[model samples]
Target: MAGTKTIDADVAIVGCGVAGLYCALNLPHALRVVLLAKTTVDECDSMLAQGGICVLHDPDDYESFFEDTLRAGHYENRLESVDMMIRASRPIIDDLIKRGVRFARTATGELDYTREGAHSRPRIVYHEDITGEEITTHLLACVRELPNATVFENTCMTDILEGFDADGRRVCRGIVAEDAGGAHLQVNADATVLATGGVGGLYKHSTNYPCLTGDGCRVAAEHGVLLEHMDFVQIHPTTLWTQKPGRSFLISESARGEGAILLNDAHERFCDELQPRDVVSGNILREMRREGAEHVWLSFERVPREELEHHFTHICEQCREEGYDIFSEPIPVVPAQHYFMGGIHVNSDSETTLPHLFAAGETCCNGVHGRNRLASNSLLEGLVFAQRAADKIMRDRFAADTAAQLAVAASERSRFVAGSRDVTDVALLCGAE
Candidate 1:
């Protein structure tokens, strides 16, 4: 891996999802960072998130938010992780706004917050139905302007090269990557962060992007990194059921938050609309099994017609295009594989078991979300931990020593490739084996 096409950086971040983007934004400008993505930055799972970031904007809102999250996770959540996430919420939101991310606002010019199931108040800040798209676009712009940051799109990392360097101490030298053109390249760095999203694609039915095949977890596992709680996968309730089995389209939870109702084949509400996502999804599954029906229904009659027309124009139009009048009838739906509750294990500072390695977002299980995640909390987690990881790295001066090692590795690689005549295509260099 070290002798492949040589490149050097102080820090190398994998996957350009919300976590990687925010980490790049928070790192010191002097630190040379390289961000790798299998596709364009916007193609990651974060861009597909329709809900907004969750936060307790008012003091009175904390208890409900905390309880709802705990209930959703079946009380398996780590208290410290939950507290840190709650505390970091304000700063992350503030920073996002400061970085020019536009969120929906009320007519009075106040941040418009919406309430999802299991939430006691309106605490979700979004941009219509495309919250993730807005945030990613803004963060990507900020990253582009950073002098020390470089983004490699269409580059897929195959493995983390970890071993004793020339100095004979354990270290991560770099990664072997295959570019779009199938050319192999070595990206050497001092420290590496895996911000790859979830493993939803591992299941037959998933709402995640096609490329999210747990590549990060597999890479880490190959290096003997211990992963925790891999069995807890969260299936989202209310995905649009199509004739095409297992390719269910995501019907955003925001639809239910805005007053959509879930119905059974008998046209009766099957579960409490205000229950946590896991409960709702589980209940829907149970009902389907009992009735021997292929799918359930979600109706939007409770939402004001005008509000639906204004706030959910896209969904309404899509429903209409699907030959369903959402306002008048129930739309067929079923749960689909959505978020992964388990990932690379990390601590409060988002540090992985490996030294100088940090992870965040859907790729790392920081224990903030134990068995399940409350709707919209995923984005806030990414933003909060990204800053935390950046602060820890800067405080420890980890970049200085790591950057030097990376330079040396790059030099050695250049020397090795100087006389080599067999040039391999980049795309075939590395991939899921």
Candidate 2:
């Protein structure tokens, strides 16, 4: 305990993916910010995102976009959150462009928009196929350059320390984390944000990084925080089927958006490919069951060869490495757990039930996605809400400062040894360690 390191900040952001980085960038430069990356910055699930973020095509398109998201979510989505995300799309995109994140453009210099399933129009703005990497790498670079921001890699947040204010209201004080060397680090902050990714690691097959085992949700649950729709997990309709075990390669839904089609063993087109993900996943599973096959075939022969090479180079190379050619043949594909639509429930401001604690991205269920998520909307929801969270944090800085005043209420806060606390300690209380 004597060797434990302690750091303090105006804000502590857990996770270094798109949501976390974006939130940090939006915070005021005067605030001392500390960002924790469970592993290396490159290992976040956001880097593995293949599809582009969604944008508003027109004022008239808002209703359609809203409907697409609600329909996919089975109408259970929070209307206000949906409206907020849709309205905030363009501004977020503008910020990204201003920050030097590039999206594909046409010869006329207009942004290149692609269509994913369930969308009525072309609203997805991408950079070839590696949109996520382009966006996150730029954000990470920007984060590194910020004088007030500090990033810690290989740090695992083991618990959210809780203490009561003078009024006896339970509030968050800080977090306990372990570095790569297993040394304990106590991070105290005025505001704590949880942008940790989803529960993909819990599945046998997922498109998410293995380290993302719903750590945020598990931690929130231990603290008695309200979580919504934990059972609502989204299974992507197309991940490349392979005999080897590990992270499954996602065959981006954009491929189907570009004119590829799914086929049964008889090579017959079954359901419409542009339906919501649940419908498509159900159809695929039904087809597999009826045909007694492990996977269905997705053919891209009709898609333009030049476009395939230009837009999906990474996918093409990966398939080629596996002895398949996207330009000439169909690839074996199946559904796998892709996203969690439920997590620590938050308000429009992204503040959780716990005082001074907020969550964003896939780690928080603001009810934007409702029952399921529309394709390409995940990134938009994250950026929009994360920005909102930062705005709220800055607006109520006085409240956070008051909460920060209570940091030393519990003298044993940093005295608990790393991974040595029992049921009586905050670590066990938060279901970590």
Candidate 3:
């Protein structure tokens, strides 16, 4: 790190996705926090999420939702994590609503829910298809209005500095970052949280934004943090294909739930629409290889054109602009990189193995989503874990004690070394928090 100016904060959070934003919003007002984002807040993958959050709103729906999630993960998920998520589902939605997020409502004035593959019931709460956008937009606004939170945009964290203190226990002291203007700065805090989103940009074709380059995983690994199941990348089953390579667009699964049919070049239904994403993507890949075709077709003719236009107006317009009438013609699609099922492993509380480091959202694998994630579960995971982390922080009061010690130590050290400064002052240099 180049710039040596020092600033104090109770906590420093990296990445401004839903988890980061929610955590900042829920943290105590007395605890000053610095929230860093590699790009603008809205540019994160959370905004691109067209699907909603999955929750067991009805008491009767819990068992079926749990079973569907376990089956989607191929039964490899940790049971405790699944139960925690299931229990947190409704509360998470209620919390978001309290934060002013407007979820889709039914004609009867009830919360509107939708069904996706592997789900047993319509339990997804959304704002039409742009649910993530609505939630993130509102939460971001709330975080900005908080006096104790400071947001840093276009700032990229290079690495986390970890070391052992007097007690010989591991600790994360601070972070080295490069701002948008290319100036390197070191930020130290009492605690650091990593909420960097997924690793979708690792693939050539992805529905994620360009900034998601596995930075969190790589940074955690460099600091000797343990990672799990890093190879289980989730490829979305339906993505709009362009003649150009590596620019596929997401065609949300809601389209299929609305009655679109996946067909091969020969006009044959190739795979089960209700299968898990991994299975569906695999089937689509096999059909493409067997039929010797570049892409498959998704036909929405069985659904009314007006209804399709009303719910999926953006997709319909894009399809029309791409020279295909979604109502009358088949829209070309293929499997594209979507979500990362594996990440820095954490427990139900969203705490990582590293001390003073917490993680949530797509960056951390909390095991609620084991081998695969059920549709609309991503947003719920973020909301649930963000709240869990906030509750843990408040209960533990780690910020207050650490910040006090750090501030006192800095004040005393400055007095001790005031008149005995040397050209090379490594002792005066403090690590990032």
Candidate 4:
């Protein structure tokens, strides 16, 4: 093992995806931040998200938007979280624009909107098919230019360090992280945030980076943090079926939104293409079972050829590489583990049950996505909650006097060094939360 190193910051953010990057960007510039990535910053699942992010197009669309989200979640969602995410949509979009992230726009200069599964209206903002990449890349660029922010790639947070506060409440001091070179790092901070993506690594097949194994949720659980909705996992209805043994390529729901159709062995439409993820996945599974088919076929023939080339170029090229011309024929697809709707239970401000610890993105169940996530809402939910976490931390935690901050950090560091522990056992691992 390499020698261990220690560092201090006002905040320590785990994961460098959209949620982590957005949280770091929204933090007060006066406070220093240390952002950690498990691998290269661009290797996150957020960059692989092809579908767009949902937006509340107008005030009048609020009710329908809420209903759509709840319907997709099977009415198990927390209303307040849903409300907060929807209301915060416009401001988040505006902030992204200010940070130089551009979404698709029409010839007349209006924001281009698209529809996806389970949504009642076309309120998604995208940049072709790589919306997540577009937004996350912009956030990464913005974070790189911040004087108060420092990003460390190839740093995996192995465990969250917990210490007792003055009031005897157990709180998170920071984390023990390991880098690719085998150097162990002790990061102590006034606040700690986990934006560590999802549980893709635990699945046989997924539409996520294979490295994401719900590390944040697992660490939180080991520390006795309260988790929620441990059983609710969302399997995407359409992933390009390659019999290969690795991460599956996702055929974004936006294809169906733009007129793709699902067919079984008999080439018959077996289910509503626009249903929520769980519903669609269940329907496909049933069809596969009933027809004795290994995979279902997804046809994009009905979509306009020009739109296919322009909006779904990545998917088209990938399919062609697999020896299937998506424009001419249907491609094989199957349900695969996509997103987790359950995780470390967090409050409205993205605070976990543990004091001084917060979680956002797929790592935490803030309840915006209850039983299932609506199509294209994952990216928006992630950024919205991440910004909220930063907002709360900066305003209430790190905005204190410098003396107080220093004292807190000193105390936490002393306690952490005395304990000196690393997470080696992952017995707390679960199927979902």
Best by lDDT: 2
Candidate 1 per-residue lDDT, tens place, 388-431, comes to 88887787566556887889877876765675565652222322
lDDT of 3 by residue, 263-354 (tens): 99989997788788999899999999998998899999877775686667778877888898887889999899999889997777788888
Model 4 ranges with Cα > 4 A deviation: 402-433
Error of 4 at 253 (Å): 0.5
Q: Which stretches of candidate 2 lie over 4 Å from their true place?
A: 398-433
- lDDT by residue for model 2 over 172-252, one digit each (tens)? 887889999999999898789999999999999999999999889999999999999999899999999999899999999
Residue pair clashes in candidate 4: none
**C-alpha root-mean-square deviation, each candidate:** 11.2, 11.0, 8.4, 11.3
What are the clashing pairs of model 2? none
Give the range of the ten consecutive residues with the poorest summed lDDT in model 1: 424-433
Q: Write the per-residue lDDT of candidate 4 for residues 248-349, one digit (tens) a residue.
A: 999999999999999988889988999998999999999999888889999988999988999999999999999999988999999999999999999999
Please say which candidate is ahead in TM-score: 2 or 3: 2
- In candidate 2, position 137 carries an lDDT of 96
Give the alpha-carbon lDDT of every model. 0.83, 0.92, 0.84, 0.91
Full candidate order by TM-score, most accurate first: 2, 4, 3, 1
Cα lDDT for residue 378, model 3? 91
Positional deviation of residue 365's Cα in model 4 after best superposition, in angstroms: 0.4
- Worst 10-residue stretch by lDDT in candidate 3? 424-433
